[model samples]
Target chain A: MPRPAKKPRKSYHHGDLRNALLTAAREVLEERGPSFLGLREISRRVGVSAPSAYHHFPSRDAIALGLAEQGAAELATCLAAAPANPSGSLLTYGEAYIAFVRANPALYRLMFGEGFPAVSQHSAAIRALRERSYDIMKAGLEQRLPASELPIAGLFLWALVHGLGLLLVDRQIVRDGDLEDIIRRVLTLAGTGLLHGRGRDDGQSGPPPPPPGTRSA
Target chain B: MPRPAKKPRKSYHHGDLRNALLTAAREVLEERGPSFLGLREISRRVGVSAPSAYHHFPSRDAIALGLAEQGAAELATCLAAAPANPSGSLLTYGEAYIAFVRANPALYRLMFGEGFPAVSQHSAAIRALRERSYDIMKAGLEQRLPASELPIAGLFLWALVHGLGLLLVDRQIVRDGDLEDIIRRVLTLAGTGLLHGRGRDDGQSGPPPPPPGTRSA
Candidate 1:
């Protein structure tokens, strides 16, 4: 038999180098963060000429823009894939949002972080994707909340999930042993009307919490 | 009388030049954005030499870093000024956060927008200020929530306000007419735990509103 051909030296093209670049970019973003990422470094890691990487992404910001688009797509998936038995699809979308942010902290960061401003301003594809995602969110809300409440509901849920994502990604909400527990606790507080309906002192707006250095009742 | 006129433009040494440069830098950052921001521009705006701007901020990124710090300081002040009435504190914080973002969209954008990193790593003063703000949220929660839940509460509420800030600043949560109405609704939802705890189900995360194509029972 002919000598076994040595495995093709990992093909220079990486088969799908456009996607390959995104994956590599995300890795760098997550590991070293955006500040340390370099297009040449991505090319070197993929064993391609630095210029070759440009064919896939015109510039570093382009790479960042692509990643942000991916984030919107993934977020859409998260919203679509939430539990089926919920009272409102909007609620499920919100939970999925928090989950997606928690699961892919770096990618989520790219979706909203400052280094990717062009993603919001220039990319039609990315903008359309996010717009569609928000539309999905709005539709998801009609299941339980009134039509008038949709905008407010959408905003509140969006803020809670996005905020939680930032905290988890930045390590601001760390709990060594009971990580999920605290998240669930927060989720309960956010998704339910437990806090507001109860203790309604005519509910115009409840009083502020007691000031610091003051005794609790 | 003619000789007495011109005030010498208030000759500023290095120390004073620092503040002047920072103020000028922020003016440019708000007007021109990051890509167009430059030393020559800042110096021209401040009536100083291009080299003088360098004495304060070594590079454009350094100016950005300083602006971001200033933005963080402003954020702390805004959050601190929210009302202290227990029933309204949490809710008012959300509304106040929205208002600040609305009033200073570009500067707020610079504070948290892409390419701009959190000030925690760049300036000790900013970091301390940011921490103090977080403490306000944390302390507020401790007064209303169980001790075990305080940290999560702080994270959740801060995320609510900050996330709301970003969304509102970006017009993602549009504030067309009677904008305050939408804001108050969101604050109500957040304070009453509607966003975090609506359906009595915490096993799954929340959802965005359902889109046109989506069907729910």
Candidate 2:
């Protein structure tokens, strides 16, 4: 693909410089991961001078924090927009959450403080946005679970989606089948519990009998 | 704490050189992260020449792969060592798995190809060790679940522990409470399912009745 001609510096209004720098930083983040999110490179990509980029971002970490904030806000929006069926809302939220991470792998990592260690520590806005996302999950659970169970229940759902999303984005798990189907199945397990024969002898009475076709009559 | 004096170069026999380099590399991985796992720095820490380090590990990536293999083996051992109880073995495994990651956060990240993207792609040995660990979990599940459900069931357990560990290590979740208690509760929820009044109206009726002491009625 041809490199689009760099936008001339004059084309970026003063108010637009920060967004342009963030946009370029995101590209670098996805392409090279967080370690390569250098200010000079981002500025070069934006066709802006270093000092001009500095005026908006100050440092690479600041640019990363900017990206993180943007990611957090977008993620909150995704979670909020998930269909709110009382019984299946978590599945919808989990799907939306993973979908967002799948679409913006690097940005999701950045939001979680992957490369910039201080982003989480320094950004109250990010923390609030993160809390908002968590609240969405907790609110769904609150309808059914006791208040005392909320923390662990919320954490369970969070960890399930969080781990599943990372495993998918990181390609740590097998990808031979449909990714969305895999996600739904996994979340369903979380919702319904994985153990079979729930009330029958602690569900550990050994594997169920093999299907009729597989065994000699 | 004072820095330890560097060992003399002559002290390292050829056979010991590889181990010494790996030890220093592990330290670097923990103190910094994978991005800082440079061969030169590791050699300097080990008081060996860069060429000597190169002789053992052909490149920085080779060193990372070495670390990843080491981490994978250690994790598999940890998982294998988890006690096998038909009913509670997964909780034990999950505890052991999270314990390993908590103890060696950086190595765990490297094992998952955090900084060394090619480590997972290039190291068949690492992949095998990883598979060995997963097999341990699947073995536990196989006793109860049918063969057809193994894939999703196994992935669900993996994602739960994987996500819980990363959240703990990343400090993405609140840390005021006992982490072990939190992990136990979350895994127990996985074991028992989170919904209240299961098998009754889909468990989504509403919040349970207020505790006896809390209600004024």
Candidate 3:
């Protein structure tokens, strides 16, 4: 049942090395999470020398940024492809966003600057792609929400999908039933408020009951 | 401006070593993040032999779990202390939750099993603590949403806050104005639906506008 070890390639032609290294890096990112991403390990996986790998990525952080850019582009594509919701609700967009995150959990985290802090700061391409994804959500909102409400509304929807995707990917949600059902229900709530009130001034007032297992800080 | 180097502790009595090692581990976690966390590094930071540190923690993962437990407990205390909203709104709880994450960014990540995979799988106390936090959110929703709606409602609110807190902590949100005001606006949107509909049957329908710069996958 043991697999044969990979034979090292003597050399990769011009652009092939870069793609090969990135492919190996993606495998590492998925298998071990971002913490294990290293230029040395990636090059080793690609059956290349450290110097050869260095030709493509100057540092581990650079490789992470590369993955981030790749993830961002793919994510934007997925969002754009989601069937445009006709009901002015962001449900379809949310579904697409979470679907991307679920499929590429580690890559999604890396794109968001999870392990490599510099990825968020150094990559203009990544930022632009992120903005593109946001624009998809914003396009949905522009049709339904007032001009004044777009910014906060976009962020709210973004946070909702982002958080839900993470929790689902992290296995934080306790699944008692179909996950798709849970997602639809939660997204539905976002479209229709959790409470009866339609604005901030809704006069529903009462102290929240004490949480169980209260402990002193 | 250089500080004095820590001297090796000659020895420690019974329970003190555990706390001391944990304190040093926490410093490492905040300074270098979870990926940098290791038994050897922690012992070196504490100026203790590896064997001595191992007496308290079996492995690097055990130490990470210890930190997770500490973080979960602290988060629970913070949430429980948030002034209960009298108007059945969870804004106060959401604020408290985010404030804790902002204050302890790395620790918050660790508690949520960011770098350490086994921490989530192994810790019962951490799971219970997380449930307690969810219970706080659920308690707030119980006052407003019907029983059939509680599960999705609780998850929706949790995802909203969890996503919002992470976005804020990760610096994913561009700050054009007061962050506090932005958070309030977003949480307010959660209370009142983003759209005018009260349920899933709202009839507004139209093909969403094509996202800008749509790229083929």
Q: Which candidate tops DockQ?
A: 3
Q: Compared with the true structure, what per-residue lDDT tens digits does model 2 show for residues B1-217?
A: 2234355644345447777788899999999976578888988987767888767777778888888888999999999989998778778888999999999987876776445656746478877898899999989878777777778778988999998988887788775888778788788778664222133224343332221221101
| Two-chain complex of model 3, DockQ on C-alpha atoms against the true structure | 0.38
| lDDT tens digits by residue: candidate 1, B188-208 | 777677333434432334444
lDDT of the candidates, in the order given: 0.64, 0.73, 0.74
User: After superposing the true interface residues, what Cα RMSD does each candidate give?
Assistant: 6.3, 10.1, 4.8
lDDT of 1 at B183: 68
lDDT string for model 1 (A36-74, tens) is: 667887766655678877777777789888878888888
Candidate 2 residue A76 Cα shift, in angstroms, is: 0.6
- Look at candidate 3 and tell me the lDDT of residue A64: 84
Q: What are the TM-scores, per candidate, against the unseen true structure?
A: 0.73, 0.83, 0.84
lDDT of 3 by residue, A1-217 (tens): 2122235543344347777778788888889887688888888886767778777777778878888888888888888888875563477888778878878878877766456766857478988898888887777766554444567778988999999988987888887899877887688778765232233442434524233322211
Where model 3 places Cα greater than 4 Å from the true spot, the runs are A1-15, A120-122, A194-217, B1-15, B194-217
